[model samples]
Target: MSELITIIASLIALLSALYARWTWSEAQKANKISRLNMLLALKQHYSELMLKEHEKARAWGKDDSYAEACRNSYADYQIKYRETSKELENFHARIVADNI
Candidate 1:
């Protein structure tokens, strides 16, 4: 009867160890999923900000009065503005591609 009791106790210990290991694995997976969701939300927020910037830049480009003022105030303003806008657009495109 003592030998039988010892065997049962050993089996119970083994089962407990396995259950703990499985629970730990599940927790790790849940943490990874939560982290991934947060990263995706952050990326989406950044994308929205970039889009807003792009719209603002385009609006500035469309305003003839603003362009004239810039041109008069700075000789290379138009060139610089166009270049910067292009760079921003390229960066936005890259971000969109990465998300996809």
Candidate 2:
């Protein structure tokens, strides 16, 4: 009877350990997916910003003042860069907090 009880307890422990391992593996996979999604979003934003800059430059006429064009481009890039940086920082903080 004792041997039977020991076998049953050992089986249960083994099952529990397997379940824990599986859960950890799934969590790792989910983390990787989330990071990938974040990376894609960042890339998309960067591409969009670059496209807008390209369009702005293309729209400029030969008569357009060089100084003004340079100033506007710099200002626009700075604003967009700061906004995206803040957003990413907030997103990262949230993810870290949730994971913790």
Best by lDDT: 2
C-alpha lDDT of candidate 2 relative to the true structure: 0.72
Runs of candidate 1 with Cα error greater than 4 angstroms are 57-100
How displaced is residue 13 in candidate 1, in Å?
0.8
- Candidate 1: pairs in clash: none
34-57, model 2: which lDDT tens digit per residue? 875776587567657666766666
Distance from true position, residue 31, model 2, in Å?
A: 1.2
Per-structure clash totals for the candidates = 0, 0
- Candidate 2: the clashing residue pairs are none
Q: Where in model 2 is the C-alpha error above 4 Å?
A: 60-100
